[model samples]
Target: MIHIRFSDNNYGGEIDLSGTPGDLRSIRQSIIKLLQAQDVQVCIPANEVKPAPYDSCLNSLVIRKSDCSVKVMVAGSSLKIEGTPEKLKVFADWFNFGDSTESGYHNHFDYYEGNEWVDPASVSLIISCKYRGTK
Candidate 1:
């Protein structure tokens, strides 16, 4: 669950990405642009505030009938990717966010590792930002 509350009182919202691989992938691709931009803003009307359907079943299915190579999740302002070290390296290689020098805004990717349970390693790449919503 990612709860986004802006510094300004006018902006706030939440998105539950608990077990939705598809949503996670979609969101990852969408926000990849943030690595270059100085700031990106979003707006959601008060009338439109509602919950999306949960993906518990879908997530369970994907995790169950597959090799434990890679799993991705979105937590707040960070992206959590879990898998083997080799697999994680491969993912980092595949994350071609382009040359940062061209954009002038140097981007940084911070990784947090965990050992909640052995075998496939886990890492969380955190990108911190206050939500900016239009009033």
Candidate 2:
């Protein structure tokens, strides 16, 4: 079984797939496509302090997923995908982020690969689909 583990402070979950290698490949491709199409400057929300004052902002990230879809954030090529199972998947760990001549705010990831950053507030949608091979 190929398992994708997801976690956050409020929740932790996993999705297991028994499909073939092509399924995994398509999923990875979908994630890449979606992220590439999103804005690169995703703003991390600052925690609200009514009666308290904190100096640092929170490293908050929310992940959304369905049975065949995934919505997540990645900084440059530095994403959180692991290929431990060998039979499952593998993703690169690093890519450029802040080498642009624009706002100099730094980018976390590329949407498809070798592409510019998109608006930070953009949310990506990836539909998990099965690719059928014609005989």
- What CA RMSD would you report for each candidate? 16.0, 18.4
- Stretches > 4 Å off in candidate 2: 1-14, 39-135
Model 1 lDDT tens row, 4-101: 12121221222222212332333344334332344332211112213323211111111111234655444333333444443443443332333222
Query: Any idea how many clashes model 1 has?
Result: 0
How do the predictions measure up, each by TM-score?
A: 0.24, 0.23
lDDT (Cα, tens digit) per residue for candidate 2, span 1-135? 112212222222221111124433444444444345543222222222221121222232222222221223333321222112211111211211222222212123213433222222222312222122310
Query: Judged by lDDT, which candidate is best?
Result: 1
Give lDDT: candidate 1, residue 53. Answer: 36
The deviation in Å at residue 10 for candidate 2 is 16
What are the clashing pairs of model 1?
A: none
Q: Which stretches of candidate 1 lie over 4 Å from their true place?
A: 1-67, 75-77, 100-135
- Local distance difference test, candidate 2: 0.26
RMSD of 1: 16.0
